[model samples]
Target: MSLPQPVPPSWKDLGKSSSDLLGKDYHFHGAALEVKTQTPSNVAFKVAGSRDSKTDHIHADIEAKWTNKAHGLTFTQAWTTSNVLRNQIEVENQVAKGLKLDLATTLSPEKGHKTAIINSVYKQSGFHTRASLDVFKGPTFTADTVLGRDGFLIGAEAAYNVTEGNITRYAAALGYNAPEYAVTVHGLNNLKTFTASYYHRVSRDVEAGAKAVYDSKSTHGGVALEVGTKAQLDSSAFVKAKINNSGVVALGYTQTLRPGVKASFGVALDTQKLNDPSPVGPSHKVGVSFVFDS
Candidate 1:
């Protein structure tokens, strides 16, 4: 359901074209606190929080997830409790806790409430199917099916909004996949989005990709080009870089620190305003992250 479309512009984004803002900005911070855990038997939990220095504000959340994969059956459930500290978005402060509650939290018309969603997937030989439903003020249901083997695949998805009393959106995708290269094309019926991506493995430890996306119903329409590469430096370290034609460049590095700890750092720069005499605001950011496991 190519949902979350027609996104509102960023706080102070300077992109002249509507397509420039088609994608949401990745949330990055100079520092933050995070913790994660997983059990041997399909259970996991996470608690994370961070503050915005300039705003003197904090956002925090706790989430728990468990999946059952025994007896040829797959079922999963997740629950979250969030404290959206900012008053910027009325709903965020009121009912946006546990953000991943799916259609209820994601697309339900009703705002500021607890959300619950369930999903189950079934697979056999050359086919797989998934069904999901969310409990917000009203239930929204989604179903998707795919048929494919090792070399090729195709799928379609449809979602129904019970609260809105109508079918919300539909999507279809086709792709070809192999060990060395892959390509895919997909579109959303609701948002007028067309996206295609291609990837190729240059060797065992290096791969590159290019993606093109066009969407809009606003500002006429726009397109973006992104190219990226990831390469393994050794057994426990790697680096990644991406350049977007619109105006940004980013690079990241990750390394394992110990048996169960990992660290990462990244930076993103807006190339367009880097040399401008009258810059609107901060044009770059650096972020640090750490993960620990039992």
Candidate 2:
């Protein structure tokens, strides 16, 4: 129950805050087609009967992006089978314009035949900032000691934005994980997380937000709070809603079926009470996307 930290846009002037802090030169490519169905009041790893199962899933993604005025790069590759996990590849890079550097990596052998790697580097000069980290190790057996026991993770995120509309943004991030990592082979491991968020913009096509999250695991330590709203229905239609940290509720929609095509749909409902509990389910997804520019 941890996913909330994306809500920052509310400009009151200065040509909408210099077109939202100048930076543009974009490229996009996309693909998605999905099918999912599940009904469970109780089900965990075999022995079925509470009746409900319909699964057929397919996913494909392709991305290429570039940002000028300094440095920015993005590359993505994704594939999915069904009942979770099929194939995956991810790549991310960001340079000085975003701070110092950023990196990400993931290779999946259908979820458990795993591979993961994460690296982050950041340094700032106005209000102070710093980050240096590493993650994920183990599995890919015998490719010369499988690159020496893989799973390892480290984290950092420091913040200070007393005023910038980029609006009064504040930040704090912490991370740690290592226990012969393969995400501890599904039982995850000694992990920790702390997050904070805020954004304000109550006009111009209405926008509102809120966030707070804390997680510590090796069994459980949880805290979650989220509030969201984003509306812009004229340039192409959009909507969002979220509620997490166990008392699940999510709704999403996006539409722009012309100038390069677009379509999206999302729905989720779950009322949590752990110990192999994630039922009382309702999940739906639909996506049709396309973007190409040269």
Candidate 3:
């Protein structure tokens, strides 16, 4: 019998549980639509468009991907109305077991700018590591690793700027994950900022989470906190709400229109200035999005 492979959190995912619960799918100033389709030739296509409330401009993007599951290879291409094109190629478990490689390049035709990055990830029992290098723009290098055992995780990351000959960024994280709850603490931006997050599944239909941040470099050097909750109203609908220390409240509701269609609505309001005459004081926003998969 073979033992199960240990799963460790990626550097960017150290506080993903609470982060996702608090930040995901809560839009305040945009209306968007997306369509996704799968083709018989092992290809997938996605088209998305959005109208930005602030800019009053419509933006769109088209993306396509071809995947070969047998060989663990994937290729993706994307183009946006902003005159930028991106290409990505990924290989998994081919160079070595438990290893993955990714190469991505982006081109901005109008701006005549191009950039490329190479990344590699390796995972094994009780450990996970990854590294990336920018082929352009100072040829910076970044690496992160995590060690995990019994749901306890510790991870650290660092980045070096080749041109500057210095370490530009460093961060560390500690986390505990359980079947019903997860908690994480991170020292980020060279330990000048600290964050702690917690997530709990109260029941099958209810979930709650919170996040707090203390930034020593902030102008006020104060702690900021936000708490959020998600609840399934029924089989076809769900709702989420969150409030921050600044008296800003946001709420979102999502419903399944049918088997392949879904819609989401969200709003944000400032509680402190609900009756203020000025628009800057009584700020409010609304957003809506629709998705179709076929």
Candidate 4:
């Protein structure tokens, strides 16, 4: 069986900035705006700030990009400041017909700061593939004090086409880091996760699938199994629902508004027990979210 060709890269960028200036007592006392655009890739800037009776802060960023198809090279850099300064740079190359390599580095300048560097290379040929990786020290969280918590996360994923009508995907991941707050008083905490999913199209615009997920931490572990079916309602709308472990269920709906706009909303309800005790009222939350994408 032959797999479908990958989609070509598109030139696009998106970003959002918002601020709240009013205190909690006043409901309509903040300023906010969202901006998006696609133009010649050279440099772009955005600024957002708030100063009133409550608090004051400012944020700004600058980005640059350069892509050359003939040379098979791409470069990108971004710098931002809100409460702290951050800078990142990445370089990628199509080293061969079906091979690619990337090198990237990031630096944060502040009290007790540090930097991180990584190098990765990937090769693709038919259904078989290979990759190499290397990484250096960096901060574990955005708000760091001594940079002593630097660590690394490593993982890989692969997929294969069993035949013209079936495909499978599998992945494994691991990480090392400072003792989690939970185990800081108990001991060091570690985590590992594995997942696999399979899909087969019964007919055009229709499909059925199942997935399995396993997650383990220093303190607890759990497994979930899920299966579902999907069908297109029309050219503008569709719906999907799934049943998982312990009778938990999720439902989702999506609609296309225009040629370049779409929205999605979903809700999930679950009845599962926690492996450990909790101090909070409930172990879960029920809410709705609306998202816009173009």
Candidate 3: segments with Cα more than 4 A from true spot: 1-5, 276-282
Give residue 35's error in model 1 in angstroms. 2.4
Write model 1 residue lDDT over 1-294, tens digit each, in one string: 433222221111111122222222223456556788888887677776666644647666665655543322223233323432211111111122212212213222345545556654454455666667876635888877767665567777888988888888888777776658767777777648877777777898987787888886647567878877878899988887778987888777878888778887767778987985533236776667776766
What would the per-residue lDDT of candidate 4 be over residues 186-265, giving only the tens digit for each residue? 01112255444444455666655565556665255677677665667899876666667667555656667676455444
Off by over 4 Å in 4: 1-36, 41-66, 78-95, 111-115, 127-135, 138-194, 214-222, 271-294
lDDT score, candidate 3, position 200: 98
Candidate 1 to truth, TM: 0.70
- The TM-score measured for candidate 4 stands at 0.50
Q: For candidate 3, list the clashing residue pairs, or say none.
A: none
lDDT of 2 at 175: 20
126 in model 4: Cα distance from truth in Å?
A: 3.3
Cα deviation at 234, candidate 1, in Å, is 1.1
- Overall local distance difference test of candidate 1: 0.60
Clashing pairs in 2: 137-150, 137-151, 138-150, 138-151
Q: Write the per-residue lDDT of candidate 2 for residues 50-121, one digit (tens) a residue.
A: 111223323333222232323343333333333222222222234344343434444554455444433333
lDDT of predicted model 4: 0.39
lDDT agreement with native, every candidate: 0.60, 0.34, 0.92, 0.39
Candidate 1 C-alpha error for residue 288, in Å: 0.5
Model 3, residue 58: C-alpha shift (Å): 2.1
